[model samples]
Every structure is written in structure tokens, then in C-alpha cells.
Target: MNTPPSKDALREFLASKFAEAVEQNPDAVVLYAAERAPDPKRYVKRPTVQEVAFKRELEKMRDDQADKAAPESATSVSPAIRTNQLSLDDYPGLVLPGKHNEF
Candidate 1:
């Protein structure tokens, strides 16, 4: 009695068969299915310097507002919206380029 073929062996056999079928019939649409690992580089969207600065400024503002609203309960707040203790810094992106500067 012959033992069953392993998954890898079966996949190889099927792939070869599909390749042969395509070779034999030029017009045939034989789907060659294979699982591929995700490429990390393809999924990454690196933020610009300006974008990073803007995000930090926004977080700092939120923390400041939260602190002012509830000084006592600020420490007792949930983990998600907790302050990151961001330092105050100049946000050039937040300022408008005009004679009357706007934030």
C-alpha cells in the first residue's frame, strides 16, 4: 500500500500539472495558487518630519486640555487617553505664513 503524499509534495505536483496545462494550451487560464509572505516595506508609510511634529503638537494640546479639565481625576483616567507628557515646542506647521500670524 502507498502512503498519502505530503502537502508540499501535493502542491508541487499540482503546480507542475498547472504549468504543463498552460504550456499545452496557450489560451487556457490555469490559476497557479501559492501563499506568499507579506513584504514589510510594502506596508510601511513613513511619516514626514512635518507630519511627525504636527502629531506631537496635537497630542500635547490634548494632554493640556485634559489636565485643565480634571486635575484630580487626570491621574485616575483610563490607560488609552493617558498623557504622554509631551514637551512644549514650536510647531511651524501649525502657524500660518502671513503678516498677522495665526496658529
Candidate 2:
């Protein structure tokens, strides 16, 4: 299948053609329409099999990277450890015993 020319390539072609037309007719000003004429076969390029394969490979790599970057589910850790709240047992010696007589 043939693909359309990129925006940059079309812009360059238009600019070059406009410059040429202005150079040839310095005395008269005109809106150049000749460049607007379309040739279906001129601007499109066919993708080769190797190029298509490379594109698929790149897309697959991107998907893999996205999957790897996602957050892991809570099931991977120990069931005793809740995912949200911090577990006091994990840090020993940080707690103090409650005093009954202190005001």
C-alpha cells in the first residue's frame, strides 16, 4: 500500500515551486496554482516487508515497556501486610507501653 507524503516533504515542494515561479515572473504577482495539481503516484511510497517488520517490533517493544512500568498488584506481597496501612509489627521497638498512672 502507498502512503501519503509527510507534511515536511509537501511543504518543501510547495516552497521550491513558488520560488521558481516568482523568479521567472518578477514583474507580475500571482497566486501560484500549478503546485496544487496532484499526481497520485508521485508523492506516495510503498513500505517494504523489512520496514513493516521493524515497525511491528518497535510497537511490541513499546507495549512491553509500558507493561513493565505499570504498578504491581497487591497479591505479590505477603498476605499479612495490608497494601494501604503500615504494619506496626514490621518495625520493632518503635512502640511505647501505655502508662496507667501518668496524668
Candidate 3:
């Protein structure tokens, strides 16, 4: 009798099949699939003088902002609307009540 294929073997087989499918249909959408990894060495470096000037300007602006206390209006948020607006019980077409439901 033949034993079942391992999870790793199944995953690799599926990946190979997916790659073959992509090759067959070039226009097919696979948004999450990353074809290649980015090379750090190929990245362009920022100019040292420009970076220093930018840091100095940012520090000066931060110091100025710190000297003057932030207004209450800037920090305060309106409590009219709350997040995660839909409660699980209130959601329609629930497979099982008191459990998570798809949006």
C-alpha cells in the first residue's frame, strides 16, 4: 500500500502547478505572489549633506512645537462614532450566532 504524501511535498507540488499555470496564462492575476526579492545593494544612498540639513531643520521644528503647548482641540477626538461598528449579534446571515461572521 502507498503512504500519503507529506505536507511539504504537497505544498511544493501545488507551488509548481501554480507556477506552470502562471506561465500558461501570463495575464492571470496573482497580486500576493512575489516573483523576486529586492536587492539591498542596488538601492541608491541619500546625500550626506542633504540628510544632515534635513535632520537639523526637523529638530528645530520639533523644538519650536515643544515650546508651545499643543491645543486641546488638536488632541481631543469626537466620541460620536465608535469603531468595529457592527456587533456580531447585530450582523445578518450569521452561520452560528455569538460567533464571528464574514463581512
Best by TM-score: 2
Q: What is the lDDT of residue 37 in candidate 1?
A: 78
For lDDT, the strongest prediction is: 1
Name the regions of candidate 1 deviating beyond 4 angstroms. Answer: 1-43, 72-103
Residue-pair clashes, model 2 = 0
Kindly list the per-residue Cα lDDT of model 3 for residues 1-103, writing each as its tens digit.
Answer: 9999999999999999989988999789547866697666876777799889999999999987876646535656433323535554454455564566557
Lowest-scoring 10 consecutive residues by lDDT in candidate 1? 86-95
Q: What is the model-wide C-alpha lDDT for candidate 3?
A: 0.74
* Rank by lDDT (best first): 1, 2, 3
Q: Which stretches of candidate 3 lie over 4 Å from their true place?
A: 30-103
TM-score of 3: 0.29
Per-candidate RMSD vs. true structure?
19.7, 19.6, 32.2
Local distance difference test scores for all models: 0.76, 0.75, 0.74
Worst 10 residues of 2 by lDDT: 71-80
The true-versus-predicted C-alpha distance at residue 60 of model 1, in Å, is 0.5
Candidate 2 overall lDDT versus native:
0.75
Better of 2 and 3 by lDDT: 2
| Residue-wise C-alpha lDDT for candidate 1, range 1-103, written one tens digit per residue | 9999999999999999999998999789947879797766756788999999999999999999987979757567553445544322334445344655445
RMSD (Cα, Å) of model 2: 19.6
**Total residue pair clashes for candidate 1:** 0
